[model samples]
Target: MLIEGFIDTVRPSRNYSEDSVGRESVHPDQLDQLVRQLRIQRNDDARCEVKACTSDLGSAVWDSVSAFANTSGGMLLLGLDQESGFAPAPGFNLDRVRDQFVDGIGDGGSPGRLVKPPSYAIERGEVDGAPVLLVEVAENDLGSKPCYVRAKGVQGGSFKRVDDKDIKLSASEIFEMQVALTSQDTDRRPVSEAEIDDLDDALVEALLDRRKGSKALRGAKGRAEQLSRLNVTTKDGIVRLAGLLVVGRYPQQFLPRLLIDVTVHPANEKSAPGEPVRFIDREQCEGPLAEAIDQAVSVTARNLRTYSTVEGTARVDHLEIPREVLREAIANAAVHREYHQLFQGQPVTVDVYPNRVVVTNPGGLWGGKTLESLDDGISRCRNQTLMQLLQSVPVADTAGVTVEGQGGGIKMMIHEMEAHALDRPRFRISPDQVVVELRRHGAEIPALRAWLGGLSTDPLSDYDDAALLVAKREGKVGVTDLRDLLRLDSDDIRQLLSDLSNRGLLRFIGGESYELWSDEPRLRTSDEQVIAALSAESPLDIHELSAAVGKSPNTLRPILRRLIGDGHVTPTAPATSRSRKYLRTR
Candidate 1:
């Protein structure tokens, strides 16, 4: 036995428990009250990991902790024998085992020192009557990462959590991390060899003219002062990476990887394959970021096909997809792409399909951002200097929008697409790139556009447009039905629905999960017809009831379920059948 009793090296903050047992997460109220709920089947899933009782404390366990700290935050539970259904290890010494475990892991743990500037919080807690030491490892800051075992050094010592195991980070991964941590952005470095002549005077003048009266460029006397104020000119009076990339005569000459390449693919969703070439046409846009963004958007818009849709009677013509949506997406790929990293001959790529458009750039979502959280509008810019340089540059077509770096462009893209009733934009992070796709939904897009054009002066977010779409088609919507609508999570669904209700755009029953909405409430959503058809003994299925309600069965399910839940009707005997009938209870 290692020892007995307990020694907590790092006390976990209150309420870290995933079980939602109570207000407190530490020290379960009762030993048995764990509810036997700790599930540890996978070797090492996203968060929880189970270590065997007889396992060596130094190597595998500490490596796992370092990997967790360096990747997403994870849990390390010791004293659980995974081979035996992960029950508590027999004869596990609480204090002695914890001491061994804690000794090898911290911000700077042991000879290998997995975590640096260490801050791995450890807690001694019980689960199913077992002494398990919970090592809670949070992902280190981007500036403090690539936490590696000191003995192995950064290249070999660093470990990252893949699917379930701690895999050693590749040399490239380590280099990237080291570069990212040590140099948050390499764009601030001035090119000593480059001179004032390297930067294009026209580009500088254009930028200055665009921001003439703006406070961003106030009191600037000359090009040097202007560049100095923007922090693009170093103390040596040489152009930095930011100034060169944004206004230099040839940014690609200075940094070959700094350009935008857009390709127009020629396939729709359901189509035969073409010659396997990436696109039917291609263009390499090589200017500063703003001009490149504009060129890319212009070429992409030119190659796409258009269609006409009649809204109530007025015919509105648009690209198969919205132009502004594509513009915004392309702008995003250009403005936020990493300039220092090797593009491997691939610059930003915007692939256009007959029915879709995808804008891709060289870099994953930076600083620990996941795809699911991108829509929340939390942004971490990879090129801080580049982003700041565009502060005075207005987005080409967006009147009040500029490269303000507020992260609103993403939301705007989603909103515009949602309003047009086109497909929702999908953002994904692959190993080496970030992709944003805007796909067209066949012919439904025409109707979607018309429906959108009919709205008043109000600007609808992606969520509102989605709720309206559901309401228009079905006459009713529920919180659960709108899960795929906006970025707000389940906790905020009620607030969203209530906000819509207060705006008179929707109406919901008190505390009910469903909301009532309609363009024509009487003809489309009136439930009286549904109620009238029911009697004391006669019930009807959705298909049969749809005729009486004058609404589609698919759209009537919520109204029917709500009516039933409130005792307005009762099901026939032998309930729960697919063809079940109902009776009026009231």
Candidate 2:
């Protein structure tokens, strides 16, 4: 019945024999060879008179149809000159010729004929002024053995595919062909005895809710109407695969593997340890998917810790771990997990930790989707029906959040983490496992420090010491002045400033208008002593400083300016004809 529709879609202009359908255009040279092999009379099935209006058709044409349908269907072009090699020469009455071919094949009484009459269409066209008919045949789903050829007296025969040849089927082979065809019809029978109650109610509710506010179901009228709208129920009122997945009282009744498993472990125990790891609490939950997801989320939330920062005055810590992100990730895993793990006792595993959480589900990146593609929002859901159902239910936060069946959850989770300055979630895949690890913000930084600590011999740089020295002795020093004084670069100086400020050793003040750093303590450095000594006497020009310290003016200018900026020195007078002078800020 389905094949009939396909036939109508692809109308062929002429009827072709099973074997001749896929025959390549008969070449002008090959025509002679073919004629010789068939031992046909010179003009039989051959284009006689390069432009003749009519010619006798060959009986061998039927075999072409059988050949094509048995294999990948092909087309056969007729009315072209085989001897002259595709030279356009219109032949007599193209429609009549096509009708004759169709009638001959459909006659059914022809010797050794078993070809199912193919539906064909006819058209008139000119090939270099020569009439030609195109016959297209479709490959039959009849497996590898429905083919046949003219035999002594038999109507049905057998054939086999050899290297570009159709070898006749043996008697034993013909018997086997009959057996296969008889069983094929029985094998494709529709599933029976399936009922609506076999579907998971939660799953159905979820699916309907997914299309909320759509006129598609007339608001589903009620549970039965909703099931009918989803095409989960058959005309005879039996439940289908889609129905069994959602709102079914017992989905496992029809599909036993549709359940999920959620487990929680204490801080130290994965399995029972020699000494049980004391947990504030621990629980394992399992059931129809919706309940399992809710319980898992609740447990995860209860176990997670809320972190606070010095800027607590800014925002509250209601959710340390994003609830929506976690819910979607968990729901996606359950919906997409492979339900056919034969020996595996569990389908999904949710492990909760004090500082992190891990969800492992069966099956890896499916449908050509890889980790890279997952992050790029390439989604492929292996179970479309189940996915549609899950979509109906409201997401944790809203009624209409759609989970991308294309595996976009990874990107979403990463985005959420980035929002909180948290580490990106890690994804790993093994033979039959897919694992996602969500680490709490700042949890891994300390471990990284400990690891780096063991790998080095030198102590880490102490920027605070440098910042304090510059601040106490130099008072308010320009960044460049501080760098030169400490023999550091701009970057190192900036790092010192930032570290000091973060540790409460220093504070930033002033707007961008006129920024300055001031000392939180009094002077204690040799440089401080030098500046104090010079300033206490009076302000001195670079030349005066060079004379006093017995150094070049170039060398003395830097130290004097730093002192002046640090408030250790004050200008005695503005620029004058002689030289500018400075004094200590007494």
Candidate 3:
């Protein structure tokens, strides 16, 4: 009674306005800026389109709407002349164009309705004192994509944006959009052709022993019952794809493409003079998922350069790329890649390069995960059963440890790289594939070393070498570019660039961009060097030619074969001749 006027809680006040309505307005200033940009470019771009709507709302507007909605959102500028340097259309009737656009989008009886629902905003603005309409199309939700033109129908009308043009979606592309709408169950489906005998008995036994404590398998009567409980096999004794992949004698025999294709490329094939045209080493890792992971890791490791150091008379061999990091990447690919029929044709690829190792798997980040959110302890697997099976399967060489269990592989990778003073791994996720790149730190290649040598003698910062390398690779880099690559703040990026500039390593071009200022001599490509050596000295045997080009005979063999095939060079002897010699076909 004494505190009758006191309120313990307060409700937030709500404000509703035209701007806060179902569709918000794109600000006039922003629209103005977009128009200015369109004028400067004199053409439409990926995110902005201009149309002259002085007469009527053209049907082409809906095509842009469908394309923009399917892809990332984009803007439409009506009453702008795209053909006339993006100038405002003369005699633009804002009222007439706005009415036509509204009726075309909203009126069910009208001929220009969108086939599906998508978020959008509409506003009116003036460009160069000429009336115009700004319509911003929002990207549709993932589950409800492929928005199309109603008149042409979904299949005939749906389009995707490529560069500045809207291209029609193929049937396969439409199928992929629908596939992403549902949770994946492809791994759990029974392989009707595969029987219980197809599975490897020893692997199955070990997996059961590893999963002995799992409540799901507790009190199971026999191996059949346990496998059924684990979703590894059907009641009829038919093995599931997951079962075959995890424990089959050789999964690739049944599923040919379910394997890893590993390749070791030459260091700077484009720039390293006399580098071979073919791979240094390549292997197809085929077997059960567990065995394939092991094989992939081993094949990649053997191809990498090793640095040996003596510590108290004991030599420690360190791989250019850490072994643990490599294994983790392969394991993740095997456990997480999509097993759907759409992607079964695409095998996992592990490409080892001079300065980095790239591992790619079909299927992008699933369960609504983003690159920024990967290390936030949120793990989502497309193949839950496959992941569980891998978690129960122990590594062949390591004792008392599963391939992967805690979903902490990314964290472990980060820690391992940091401990070794290496750059953290980078990820690239697309709609159909996910790629992980592990770059070697302080493993300076010849091109990078040459560029750094031209700089001042002063010691550079920790990330200076990496940043300069990026600049050299990309031609020019700005603060934002360095920020994304180095994960540094804007202020820190400015400081780094300024320091590099003071050291005469980089020069400020306009607009926060810096061009690398090095006068190092440009080196000829490997192919060029080989061609030049052959021109100078004709009819050289493989070993002599290898000496002249400074490339190993094993590496030079492929280049010579390629040149002969290309009709650039001719061999003096038969295919099996040990004394074969090569000369230019001049």
Candidate 4:
């Protein structure tokens, strides 16, 4: 389902009736609550928009509406003004403006015309008792896309929300949208520029040998037959882009952007988070997908750390980031990248850094995927033919180990990282790119220690200090977990985490329940026997709190009383209370 449908599913069933205003009465929804949640902040992105009525509201406001519909559908707040940090529009006349908007989005239209086939959900709500118009636009059916403004035709009026800006559709982009609507799989598109002879014979032979070993395809016969069976190429000898990319001598020679660019950068201590970056080792892989993934991995491994640690008997070598992760990232990018839209100068880029590696592929999450949905390990291939071709290249030693096997890639990547004692990889989406940032915790100790060393001396800053100190002691920190230790609310925890991340003290791991604060917990207590287990910020129930500290509540009573009497601790309840929980006195 599209994002709009997903949002709609969460909205409770509402029976509509005509209000005096003649508009369909939308039953109670979180729209009012949503207004309250986002009233004070200004973050207008692809998923959100804050529109204050202008004199020519129909033209300007409708453009954003069309942009939202053509791309991912988003919430449209009409009475929210950016000048006052998205506060309710000043001197806003709710009834007149709502009527104007209702008429503007009308289908049998003319007076206040906008949106060709009006497919927007408008709700009247209030923010701080000031009426706010919340309009939610649904993404158009892929076939009838380029949801345009009434004045300007589809070619001129179509707009897509890219990051913060609503970019007008170029001629090529409009064409691509049409193609995307018509075609379910882009990889099957034939490469008219290339011939049958363009594909490398050796790679095809190797693939055939691999396929012959697989139980599913053991009976598969000739090269052409195998390619046809796998849907890699057309039966009429028209080489598909997928077939060419998988085994062609040079895919980029025909398809210029069908390649991966690998860059390894030297560790720069002075490079700020937001700055023009520089690279040391640069290599471009334009060969067949089989060789390109291998080449990219080999080049990246040069800069990656391979340190040794002592086990019980001897030393064991450990590469900071495992090779399987690199293969999975690169292979996935090549197999599933958007091919309908021409790659505008940006090839798939793999940036190798000291503490982390960022692999960026051009194209947002494909087929209506959000980050949470992608984490569910569901596979949606943007390029099915290419994926089929990739699955043919079997590992030499492993009898039936093919490169492009279906599913489990994400699970494998996660499991590999965890088994290596590293933080899980994070995935982020943008209008033009999909970024995967994988970090190595063992390599981040030096940076954590440096940040800890530069701790501010002032006494008033101890709260921040205590947070970081605990992070330095615990590998990761969650806000709710710190409620007792810091006596802070949700807002305070959010602000503290933001501050630490800004100051480069903590790296943020993904969060939903509460923001998890991440850092290296290498700095041990003076005894140094083991890493310190983190204490709760908010006092948990007795059993949970005791388990966190690895001691029974009865055993901790004396320690709790002593600390409370000494003014270092306080009990939320009476001393004899069964529900007693302790908080650090800060």
Candidate 5:
């Protein structure tokens, strides 16, 4: 067999030269030299024998490979044998040896003999006229790990490489190896019966509706059918992790610590004196995943405040917080939480403040991911089953949301907040928890209040506040011009402008598409001077005065009538048009 061929390649040499074995060339001379050097030291680190042509030595070869892989990885020479006398060693047959080795490695029935990384390559060379196969083993950085070797009539033993020889690993090494293999699966045991029936029907229905477009969900006719289609059932017809989280009647019954705690504290409490920091409100929401999310959002919305905007002559209340965005963030926390990572009594928490809302889950991010890569579409879900179930729920639309997986909840939340000129949510990951904070409408910076104080006194609407900040820094802006600057929709821009205009804080320049705004004091004085200048230049008509003063015709008519009634201006007929005009009654 090829094992014999690989063994034959191990020829004894005259000197114990390590440099000769380390050479890059796989030439016949170099292989011979390497083989000779290995024979001198009995293959002590300088070289090792690999039997690629024999089935009898399979276990031995695997043990040797495992030793090298667990310690410092190295090369094993196959298709060669140890030289007995050293009288110009003879070459071994190479035919069929490579195929035999490949078949043995690929055998599925073999226990504790899985390929490493699977993409590693092997090569063949020659030594002492004998065919030599080189099996390069790369070290596993997963620690000084111990790997198992399969034996015929007995259970496999843990092996490691130590002091240039393959030896049985110690008890401590074996224990560590067992721990590494079982840590991830230890927390994923089957769910209990008490929690099985706790699945929420509403959440299950929502999940089924979302799965209507999925190819995997095509066979399911209803909610119960879809649950089975998603493999969310155990052998006893009990719900699994997916069902327990999405539809369970009492989700906290299974996961007692799954509920989120939301607390609102006074703003000054962060650095308050001896007085105890008072909480505005505190609520604990429980139930199926969807219900908990709904409760959390409703509570948050009830506590939030909406600012009124003066649109034209009327004031309208616009939603200060984006309900859809807040809901998505809460859902993401519920779905991505590490249910198995909790220890004794701690649970997930969501803290709502006047300026920001923080959603924190128990457990750090999975899969070596970093904050920079959070928005890069790379995700490692700790609760994949939970994620899959949540993805099937239609609580919110995540289209254009860039978070990984079909559940773009995080991405959607960020996008919505940004679209409204709010700061992007801040994410923090600790060894025990992951927290995401979403800023409110005007809480982008602490200096926002100071900045507003520097601006005019007219109560600035949210959009107007954003526009004034942009205009102050950018210099001179129009209605259409401030839209891009403030990241507001066209309607929002129009409403903001109308609000400013009604407060006598801003005025338009004639009937131009682009209108300029001046401070209220400056504009009021300008209006008075413009009327006087027009009256002195000529007996101007009301239309001429309205056009020159940049006021709406209807608005100008009321103002002109008031001025005529007050004896500040008099009515007259212009020569060009038969219509009445206004002249200063100085």
Candidate 6:
């Protein structure tokens, strides 16, 4: 089978019209194209599901309702037969099926109500003269998440769409969604398993001394009252999770996984074999958050190998990854990680490779922040209480300065890396975690220049060289990546990419992305893979082709050029435009 995993399944047609409620609904003629796509795939996908409910509506439809609402919204098609290549079902009753679906999703008190807080738009469409019902479900907000079947309740009925399947959500996942809706700080919650005496005497004294200028400490009558006023203790004298994490003598006794783990690998990639042991050094730092951050940094720094350079006739030695970068990366991971009960078992990790160091924490960007916004100094605190406490809790051996709480850690890391003439740290973000990779500036320029020297006779500009390097490293380079790298506007980047594609140095990879061009024919093993992928669905661009073939666009460019020359493929537009696409030649 062709590699279709990288491509999103066919989307419902966008031909839309406003309904009585001002919501956009799909037009009836749109069903024809959608049906053809469904037939070609011969299966359902994440965005659209097919059902052939001809006689009556049942529990299956409600399950999809919950799944679509809980995850990204999707289209639910009724009277479509999944068993027969999604053809219109035999003996389908369009009006009856549509009425039943409407009643089931209505507000409370409806006899057929199946879901809570219904959010959908319905339309009646026909394909091949067969009537069909299309319902577009909307995703619920955090407060209304885990939208479940009314009969099954949230625990048993809640479902989320994972690819083509509707999977039941775990209790912990539901609890996390509920917790996220609350206005209170999650770290301020009392740790019922922890005691007041769990707070370390010296650490607590240090914290109190640091906060001496605060009005809360001055207004308290005694130590207990002082701790309570400072949000370190609940009214019943139980230690709060944030306070325990900051000053508790043994916070891990109650929350075992709230720590940092560090590991040093022998090579750049984990797949490198022949090593007797997986890690050269491994250690888990526990105790309070401040101490854990410090220890993790120390362990990672100590394991690193340094290099020397001459400055002003003097030899200067520098750690592979700077000490400040390590500390900032570790501290950010500890402070910003999600504190919800669902993620309590997951610990922050720092992995040291020969060429880079990767630090990961159990949470993606919170509060709707985007990766592009990091350079803008936009900050969102996932753990406000923990951040507040850390703002005053000085590092153990520092000169009276706090660890890090001003929301400048990312900016500092960027500045430090740029100052050293190293590439800015790269971030990998997902729903489960956020990882930052600090790469060593190891001969990248020399290697890229050496590679480019053979590609062209004319001398290329520095920006062209930089863009090619990015495209080679990252499978493809997009307008956004170039903007960040070159500090150029969208139009300039587009023009530059077009010029490169014209000069045969880069290939436009659809969706405003480009990759390096190649001319080696012996390295064209992906010829069949590309053909197979396009055969399944025509008119895929270099971006989709590269992702599907699991090769860089640079690798596919030469193959595509040869295919077009041999009449095996055709371009949808001129090669200069970023939107140019390729398909099997008719």
Candidate 1 ranges with C-alpha deviation above 4 Å: 1-43, 53-55, 79-96, 106-112, 117-136, 141-144, 170-185, 192-201, 211-237, 263-282, 302-315, 341-346, 351-407, 422-443, 446-468, 477-586
Query: Model 5: per-residue lDDT, tens digit, 147-226?
Result: 45544211245556655567776543444343332334312345765443566666566656656678867765755566
Candidate number with the higher lDDT (4 or 6): 6
lDDT, candidate 5, at 128: 50
lDDT of 1 by residue, 1-586 (tens): 1011111324334223324222233455422222143442324465666676564564666677668767876766677777666677887765565556555553124443454734545565677766566656666766677787766777777787876778887654565565543336567878777788888777677667777787767887876887777767886688888888777788777667667777776566323455555458889888677777778878988886666545554665677667778777877777666655455356888877776777888755566666777767777777788777776555455544336677677777776675555567887764356888888765676667567546634555556666777777776767766655554577677777777787777776545444554554332235566677878876787788877767897787777777776667677755457877777785
Off by over 4 Å in 5: 1-189, 201-214, 217-226, 268-277, 310-316, 341-344, 377-380, 394-415, 418-421, 440-465, 472-516, 519-586
Error of 3 at 559 (Å): 64
Measured with C-alpha atoms, the lDDT of residue 322 in candidate 5 is: 79
Error of 5 at 183 (Å): 12
Global lDDT of each candidate = 0.66, 0.53, 0.75, 0.65, 0.57, 0.75
lDDT of 1: 0.66
TM-score of 3: 0.67
Candidate number achieving the greatest TM-score relative to the actual structure: 3
Give the lDDT of residue 209 in candidate 3: 88
TM-score of candidate 1 relative to the true fold: 0.62
Best by lDDT: 6
Could you give candidate 4's per-residue lDDT for residues 375-439 as a string of tens digits? 57677776766776777665434554335455678777876665444667888765446888888
Candidate 2 segments whose C-alpha is farther than 4 A from its true place? 1-194, 198-242, 250-260, 268-275, 278-284, 307-315, 341-344, 395-408, 441-586
lDDT tens per residue, model 2, 288-357: 4565577677777777666322222353343566776777768777766654333124556677765677
Q: Which of candidates 4 and 6 is the stronger one according to TM-score?
A: 6
Query: Which sections of candidate 6 miss by over 4 Å?
Result: 1-33, 107-115, 190-197, 219-224, 235-237, 263-281, 298-329, 338-343, 350-382, 400-404, 407-586
lDDT of 6 by residue, 257-337 (tens): 989999888778674566677788899999888888889988988877665444455666667567899988888888888
Please identify which of the two predictions, 3 or 4, would achieve the higher TM-score against the true structure: 3
Model 1 weakest lDDT span, ten residues long: 1-10
Model 4 bad stretches (over 4 Å): 1-56, 70-94, 107-146, 160-165, 169-182, 213-233, 266-277, 310-314, 344-346, 396-404, 442-586
